[model samples]
Target chain A: MTEAQTYSFFLGCVMPNRFPNLEASIRKVLPKLGVQLEDLEGASCCPAPGVIRSFDEPTWLALASRNLALAEMSGHDLITGCNGCYGTFKDALAVIHEHPDRLKEVKKVFKGMGLKFDGKVEAKHVIEVISELGPDYIRERVTRPIKGIKVGVHYGCHLLKPSKNRPWEQTQKHTFLDELVEATGAESAKYKDKNLCCGAGGGVRGSQVTVSVDIAKEKLDNLIEAGVDCIVDVCSFCHLQYEESQEQLNKELGEKKYQIPVLYYTQLLGLAMGLDPTELGLDKHVVNTQPLLDKIQD
Target chain B: MTDSISRETIDSKDIDPEFVDEIVKAGADRIRTCIQCGTCSSVCPSGRRTAFRTRELMRKALLGLKDEVLSSHDLWLCATCYTCLERCPRQIKVTDAIIIMRNMAVDHGFMLPEHRKASQKLLSTGHAVPIDDANREMRKDLGLEELPPTTHSNRKALDQVQEIMKRTGFKDLIEGEKMEGN
Candidate 1:
């Protein structure tokens, strides 16, 4: 068995504030997977790459560096469940490394806070942590094995983008997430535009709700056509877009059209590990996950 | 009729020849090498539904159309998925250029209202989306703490984040009365 790993957990705004359920799932599953999560206490927002980075580059770098500084102080690499946060941390770090001037600027800001950041801590995604465990190791822990359930895996950009910084082999046609989904005893359903954005990133969801929901509606239409039991994703923001957009689309169309439940990857893995659905926060989803639960029972 | 005609034509006064240099300096170093191959736009998911044509935006930036580029509503439409950046044959950081342009836009006081609200939230609570009563209840129900150990629960941490924002001038940037600098 591989040695257990520990990380300073960076909880961005959405998961803890909007959907504590996803946070609950991660807390429930990672311990069983031999991953320890330490709270990066007092760590503020990943400052949200989409909104903050767009508004001011310098502030984005300094704030991201502060969070990285906290993790460095904790002596562990930082890991986040949201792709937007992951993108901010990774993109900010890449910028800091590429431009010495930016790093100097961030360090100057850290100086006042009694903090020192040597760019030691690396930002990681939860999926990256699980992927390191290998699929065989994951399969061995499946107590319930959610067999016959079809899942549409939504990678959501930022997990694999700015390819130069990411560790993924291929950004466009990557299958690491699909392979992980299959290990949970659930079939990763093939869908149109599988890599399409859930339409919530880059502050588009905040500024233009209709357009954001319209983008999500298109992807949901594709997932519906593929007959997936649920849409599993790695980002809480994407999870919110997928879940809320379905309800919004149904309202706009004046029909109960889109109903695909959205599940964070850990939630799916937790279910496969025989954890109770309630403990996984499946009961708190915007769209009912009872259909998915019924499928697993059958 | 005059308004329509003016909109159709590019005015020389609107172009700032140094704009491309500013974007390049802001970290989209390969943007000037764009060949108008349309690969970025072709792969852009936002372009499919919105007017966010990545190639067109790059062309405008290269042409130094500062006023037109910064003030366009289409500028905020990019989802920043980086699909365009990944598919660019010139290895141009297409999305990064857009983000750089967005920073420039905000510097020029062209930010969206919603974004300003988000920034305000960050300054106030250290979270773009601050925890509400309902969220607190949900966390309690989940057997988690009423607040996660983030800036929301820790006042000193929140102070540190606010300090960073203040030092970075982000507090003033968003709190300033006029976003358009009229």
Candidate 2:
């Protein structure tokens, strides 16, 4: 057995505030897999990479670097449940590390508070951690293997795009996330526009709700066409987009209502581990989980 | 409403040649490397519905059509999904270049109201979308602490975040104020 390494968990804003079910499920599942989730207390937002980074570069880099610097202080690498946070750390670190001038600026921002980024800590997405545990290892621990359910995998943009910065998914051919999704005995369904945005990213949802939800509707229609029971997502923001779009699409497209539930990756993993659906916060989903729950083999 | 052609002659005098240079300065130096390839436009999630043509926007930047690029609502139309970034054969940072243009837009007071609101929430609460009462209940229902022990729950830590933003002059930048040198 490989010794599990401890990681300081960087809980990005949306997970804690909007999707606590994700926070709980991750907290519950990873420990059983021999990974310790240390609380990176006092960490601020990954500041949402796209929203701030698009609006201001130096501020985004400095703030993200501050979060990374805190992770470095823990003497362990960092892990996050949100792809947005993952990208913020990954892209911010890559930018600052590659450009000494930017790094110096970031250091100058940190100096007043006595924090420094030795550039030692690396960011890992929750899926990356699951991948690190290996599918075979994960498969062995699945007591109540999910069966007969087709899942559309939402690989949120920051999860894999900008391949240079992200350690996982270096190429479009990378099956890391798909492999992890399949380990729990569910079929990772092949869906349309597999790599499209969930419409909640890049501040689109924040700035233009109708347009954002419309894009999600397009993705959802594709998912429904592909005939998936539910969506398995790694990023909470993307999770929110899919979950909300179910209702939004239902309203907009009259007489062709689509109702699909969504699960953050850990929530699904927790259920496969035989944790009570309630314990995994399954019932907390905006869209009812009963449809998917009914499909679960007793 | 008339279906008529309205034409205006454009010359080098009507363009800001430094526009592309500004975008380049913002970590998107690959702007110069774009080959007018329409690959970005084809892959754009935003262009499917909105008038945000990725290739045309890049071309506008390439040609230094500063006013056309900056003072248009179309600037915020991109979702920044990076699909265009991924599919661009030129490997142009298509999305990043747009972001750079948006930054330039903000400096020129062409910022989107909604983005400004999100940035404000981030500035004040250290979150783009702060915890609401509904989600507070949701967090409690999930058996986790209502506040995730972040800057939101700790005022002192939030002060540090604000200080970092202040030092970087990010607050002023987002709020549409002049930085010290300006």
For candidate 2 chain A, the 10 contiguous residues with the lowest summed lDDT are A1-10
State model 2's lDDT. 0.83
The count of backbone overlaps in candidate 2 is: 0
Q: Residue A92 in model 1: shift from native, Å?
A: 1.3
Quality class of the docking in candidate 2, CAPRI style: medium
- Model 2 scores a TM of 0.94
For model 1, the docking class works out as medium
Predicted complex 2: DockQ:
0.63
Clashing pairs in 2: none
The sequence of per-residue lDDT tens digits that candidate 2 reaches over residues A1-298 is: 1125788899988888888888999999999998898998888889787788877877888888888888887777888999899888888878867888888877877885878686768888888888877999999999989999999988888888788777664577667767887899999988778887878877788878888898898888898899999998999899888887777777776754777889988888898999999988888888999989998864
Q: Write the per-residue lDDT of candidate 1 for residues A1-298, one digit (tens) a residue.
A: 1124889999999999999999999998998998999999998988898889999989998999999999988888998999999999988888888778888888888775788888867888999999989889999998989899999999988898888889889537989889999998999988999989888999999999988988998899999999999999999999999989888888888999888989999999999899999999999999999988998999
Model 2 lDDT at residue A79: 89
The sequence of per-residue lDDT tens digits that candidate 2 reaches over residues B70-153 is 887777778777888888887788889988887787777676777777777878988777889988888888778877788878
Give the true-contact fraction for every prediction, in order. Answer: 0.94, 0.72
